[model samples]
Target chain A: MLEFDNTERTNLGELGEFGLISYLTKAVEINEPSTLKGIGDDAAVLDFSNKKTLISTDLLLEGIHFDLRYVPLKHLGYKAVQVNLSDIYAMNGTASQITFSIGLSSKFPLEAVEEIYQGALIACKKYNVDLIGGDTSASVQGLVISVTSIGFADEDQIAYRSGAQEGDLLCVSGDLGAAYVGLQLLEREKNIFLENPNIQPDLEGKDYIVERQLKPEARRDIVELLAKIGIKPNAMIDVSDGLASEIIHICEASDKGCKLYEDKIPLDSMTYETAREFGIDPTVCALNGGEDYELLFTIPQADYDKIKGSMDITVIGHITQASEGCQMISKSGKVYPITAQGWNAFKD
Target chain B: MLEFDNTERTNLGELGEFGLISYLTKAVEINEPSTLKGIGDDAAVLDFSNKKTLISTDLLLEGIHFDLRYVPLKHLGYKAVQVNLSDIYAMNGTASQITFSIGLSSKFPLEAVEEIYQGALIACKKYNVDLIGGDTSASVQGLVISVTSIGFADEDQIAYRSGAQEGDLLCVSGDLGAAYVGLQLLEREKNIFLENPNIQPDLEGKDYIVERQLKPEARRDIVELLAKIGIKPNAMIDVSDGLASEIIHICEASDKGCKLYEDKIPLDSMTYETAREFGIDPTVCALNGGEDYELLFTIPQADYDKIKGSMDITVIGHITQASEGCQMISKSGKVYPITAQGWNAFKD
Candidate 1:
């Protein structure tokens, strides 16, 4: 319903509330099986006959969660959805639908908001999740995006962070540290651009790291793959706050301790080399780098045989007695206590 | 756990993310039957058995949705949950749980955050809904609250906007214009307070309207009353954006026309006198002013006999053929086309 002219700036108010909502969601295709009713309702409705429903929410503020000067609106939108969906996948649930709300300042035009919607729709399509009802309002400050993702899983298939047994094998999906290194790259470029707008970012051969920071995907496939192999994780969580922080969550919740192998923590070659160039330890980057959006879960020792050779899975540690405490043993055979200094929600 | 003292400004950083979440929800007591899990996991788990689940999300920005100068943090938290619950009640469903996410600025001490949490927990307890999982992050700007309410209803009991027939009676619960008038009172007092701090708000007996503005309740009672009286609404919506706007939403969605009787519109004596005192039209206030949180629904005329003497429920309009158009007939017998210039989402 909103008509945005490519040649000039178009005010958001010119399109109004109904016009903007319709324009943003016009391309949203609802293919999720449980989505009985989507947009254009007081509340979206779903029918998940017998499965346990899972709900997760995330709020991404403009300046705090992301810097729009370096982060494109499209990437911000897509990453917001991925952030919430990753939570559901961490629960071993299928990411089914998302309701995305954005408060935009008048500083942005209709086209700018549309860019975010396009990216969000792309993530919804890629993850096979439907974009349900959400809201858009005029903000007094910069833009803010809030996404609530809904999913479901069979009662037995569902995983929790409080279920890890002493002998469960901790595993992580994909690599870590890349997203943090990529964020560092972007921040450097942003500073450079502010000093001189004509200088483009020197991001050659950094496509993988840049993509990790800009468009991280949720491990919905890993959730499905685990179920396909008939393995229910004893404990599970998404790798949003690095390997150490996430394991601390599982350990504290399950009332157990863990010994993570520092050498086994997954790190890409680019992440290692880039961290070295920046004078940061690659191991530290992997241990505490947030926003990877990968799945970190634990499977029973008996089920380890089933996923031993899985391509994206890496067994990093094993749960231990509570008295031992959560620690990481370095490749040099030195043990260190694991603490959650990775990402502090309270401290920017 | 984070401790809050009146004299000390406890930085949120003092208690890390896990500590903050644990401290805030330490008092949360879950009594909802559908809540299989709450707060600690990656996502909250729920089971709806054979019922259809409903979900609605709302983002309340600092300056956009509320003014902290006049709006107390406690009331802001309560009203945030109330707003989303109203959407569920409008759908003829019971709100069962809410996940409250807030991006709080460091300007707010840990005590201020706890006050918001206390108010939210109170709302959840009063509504018989569980406080499910949520996240608290640091914001560079002011506080932003995002509430996602989850509800459920039996297949046949759920109401939709597309069900109103030609002869359905449009009904509203409670009086209108009170909230808008109350807001006007607060704004006037705020201006006076800015001019001179010694003069306290002359709110005398205006407590009712002031409460309506600061703390609104969802029409859950109306939904319960209708079911108890064996009456189901043909179509329903919450009166958030004034009566005219809500009726227009119903008409546009149902593809029907409506004739609202101005004389039949319910208004409290205080609301009318207050609007007149401010040199504003009470009808205008009722028709265009927003944030009442009352339920507006259309019931088949056949069910009117059952609710003829219902408490708080007023039948103010009737549905008509699509060609008739949506109009309001004043007491003077003049018909005017209804418009929704109330509460524009894209405008301040």
Candidate 2:
């Protein structure tokens, strides 16, 4: 868990809105050639030329989306950018720019805000995306972050969720369930910390799961690798609301059903072992646990040969006729209908 | 003042996030030819072709930016879109698409959200812009709205705030200060209502100011008019932050000074009278009170004749050498330095 130092606190009111904005964004450097105008303007201007411009937005509310008690502000900032960029990459586009609007109460110090921006800047630098423009305002309660990511892709390179065809192989990048299990670990640590303030978080041996929860990366590499191998996914989506939920989305959009294999579902040993320790089924966690920023896509059967040998890619399912219904064939050879048990914000 | 009907309240939790989003966006129709793909996809794709893309975002927090006691949800939603689109118009670009992400607590009913979306749809239809994409999430507290507007303009036609020259004439579209004074009226009525719950609001003849405050429109017409007249602004900004603040921004960005005449400051009669009624200086209100959403721009002195006869356009001032400094010449011949006392969110 991250601990905030209160010794060097500077009130946000002292800088005012414009002063604070200028201070936070002073180091923003435009790296994209398409960015014609960035900060200090009414709007950011971009020259996409003949390429199609791609835009996606996500809203992260403090209590609903995250808990700052265990999550570091810098990690939160980085994760927010990753979550939005995942959408752009899911479209098979090159993520180029993002407008990050934030609303925070006066309870936060200037240094706290600086840490958030620092993390965002680091993510932007790594992803080669420009922080073009955004809005900042004081909120009445907890912090709210709204990120709108912009990208560009040729017409032929763009992939939509509705493009999936029957018999197409469903592939996912990286491993799943780690981020979800990581959150469970964080929540448990948070409860222990709240019960006893002096106890250090016992997250020493769970670095992989903890990092997956705190600083998840978007599958920009998966999009690039596909382009490099000359394989375009018929349908694509980022695994945000778990594999089951995202599969349902693709199926519903494409008017097709999917047959996912329980045995083929990739799970990290740490995630599986951690889930078992918590008395949770590892398969259920892999199916319903969300927040894995991996790319879940469907490629033609002909293209499977190119990705089969790749360690990062896993073929977990295949598209089926709509009449067949979405189902998961368990390791025991029992088939069960897939249901969207993913995280629901409105659930009490 | 707007009164929400609580007689028929449907809990937002019933719809969940996806259900709520689908319910709200069921009627969204794509009107922009540039928009290749809208909502339902990972990202909205827009084919801007050779035109440069203009992107701007604004975040509005419930308690910080508005008071729900007097501001209607529909009007609030409409004003939010107008506020973002004004930025695009400020750049002499045509707004064609917007991604509106909103975060609201469970206290809000489904109908209230529908009212907000209804208002947003009305604005989108009027502006000929597409509600391309967005994110919906449950907030821990009050409503949070973030709108990212996208537009397009030819490379040569786009106006930058740093393009102003010494000899350029400062021009403003539409009258000023009405919205600020209107807000004063609403606040007074709100306080009265809070103290005496049985009393009705005494806003008999304040329709103009009230409407200005509740539902201000972006000056898209002014941008179109300038284009029609074949005049391009050297520098431009929207008057979301009072005239003085916006003027200072233009001056600082262009590395020039400005001479704004006090008498030339456009003010509606209702705004002037209301300011006096509140025992406030109308000029100060025009200089400090914001949310006018009018376009403030600078054109070459030679292009003055084309706009001089237009009633909508007002020649308020002229650009000067950097050493002259940005100043306002009062009617009494006294010169005062322009200061940005505009709405600062950080101010307590």
Candidate 3:
């Protein structure tokens, strides 16, 4: 028998629905001047000035989006909020408030719900936003978490994939494909555990990649960083769906072409090595693997020097006129047109 | 075989997602100048001028919120949107935009999703709001629809349940008990069909009550009418949960007492008859059965003369001091304290 450390435990029923909500929203900080009221009312209050408020929603199902057998509930909740916020960030706005609609299954105890709330509250505090209001219901199947994030932006400051100019420099934030590689590693270990339950599956040296998959952060810093540098991206989209697919989207929406350099693609060391061990191409994984939650944007060539040296930014390619078409130049100098190998829940 | 008309057909595939969204939003008219933008973009843009924005969300799941054996999909879609807007109306604000998130079962063809959209679009138009952005994904179990609505109100104009004063007059809009009775009628027909599919649903002469259940409108008109009369409610809440339960909420929030009259509770003639046929107490159903989507509010006595003869207004009670406690005066002259009989999804 193995000793289990269960000393740190609490019951959710100790705090009823209202109490739990109050506890979670205690730390939310209002950064936007437009946020008139954060939490603790029938609804949140927002003053949008003369600017229009933007809102977007996304729902993540437990078994469908992640396997609880591998994901901790805390990380699941944190990642859910982050993913929704990424959409608002992609739209070039600062998230001000969110509504979380949850459908919880009976299999989950109330304690699990509180832990999820703890993580969500932490994210709200970190992002300086509020958990306004949402619906909670019963679902017979797996847990369903739907989050709607509201944001505000000056009309001219808003960015869209359709706005890329003909000769803009295409760039991305940090690295890509680590989360996908992390998923491959987790799946392999789960299989090994199934074969031998007594042995702790080997995951000794994969901290970076695993963390990327479990608790990815939205590039809120990137939004502020761009503003600081006085560079409004010609076009922008968050890389939730791998690098190549996102590039193609920019091309399609902007009616422009892109030529990317293989040598310029950024991949962490662990992601590259893990892809080899899994018998997959590192470049292909970087091009098609998703859930990185990084931003990809295009800035004019004149502004490149202002951002290229920044720690997390990368200049990967340049946008071309519409007639040129989109392609990638390989290390060996062969050009290949980009394709949308992005994740589609409908098809896969 | 009996001749049946199958000629009424609509193909959703012919109208792609964008086309369907456009077709439905075409009828939406925005009367409020604060609505900077509606639909068509990454999000519905709303500029609330000097007023702060209010937002709320709710989810209605099939087989949980409604039994499709009785409720039609179109009505379900319409209700999903209206319920969220009701939250805004409850806050004494005008709804500007709504985002709809839907989870579809694999068994449903694309047309079914479009039908739901058609209903939602019609509701948006009627409310003079915009359809912003939402997530669509597959559900392993059944259909689930979630809607988040945004509205605006001046800091001074925003009314909450916590703002009621002692001695204020309690008022309600339109009639009650109709939706509950309509539901009973639908359930009876559903039972008849299950016992024998050969029987047709004889739903004629029940239009008023049936429509109450299927397509209950948000009391936006009543909100406007109150504004016209310069009667700002001291406190307000929408009666989605029975009138008694909602009264209890107002009491608990405001820390006030109320004296309500059973005879003053409005009920339609058809609804009263249907409740008798179902062997359920009409008053009880009207007071405790859910989903009327009507406005319940309290106003200062000084403004009573301005609204006394208005067609849609019903003065039901008066607010008493907290020590007096919440009670209802029956038609038989007995008084009883109001208890919470609101729908509790968590209490399965």
What are the runs in model 1 whose C-alpha is more than 4 Å off?
A1-6, B1-8
What docking class should model 2 receive? high
Worst 10 residues of 2 chain A by lDDT: A339-348
Q: Which residue pairs collide, candidate 1?
A: none
Model 3 Cα lDDT, one tens digit per residue, A208-305? 99999999999999999999989888888888878987898788889999999888899999999999999999888889998999999999999988
How many Å off is the CA of A246 in candidate 2? 0.4
TM-score of chain A of each: 0.96, 0.99, 0.91
Off by over 4 Å in 2: none
Please give the DockQ score of every candidate, comma-separated.
Answer: 0.73, 0.86, 0.44
Which pairs clash (backbone N, Cα, C closer than 3 Å) in model 2?
none
Residue B92's lDDT within candidate 2 is 96
Worst 10 residues of 2 chain B by lDDT: B339-348
lDDT of 2 by residue, B1-348 (tens): 478888989888888888998999999999899999999999999999989999999998988989898999999999999999999999999999999988988778999999988889999999999999999988887888999999999999999999999989999999999999999999999999989999889999999999999999999999999999999999999999899999999999999999999999999999999999999999998899999999999999999999989999999999999999999999999999998987767778
lDDT per residue (tens digit) for residues B1-348 in model 3:
112234544443444333454555565555556666554344455676677889888877766677766666667788888888998898888888888887765445555666678788788878887776676666666777888888888788888888889889999998998988888888888888889989988889999998988898998998888888897899999998799988977888899999999999998889888898888889998898878999999999998999988888899999999888889999999999887665555444
Worst 10 residues of 1 chain A by lDDT: A1-10
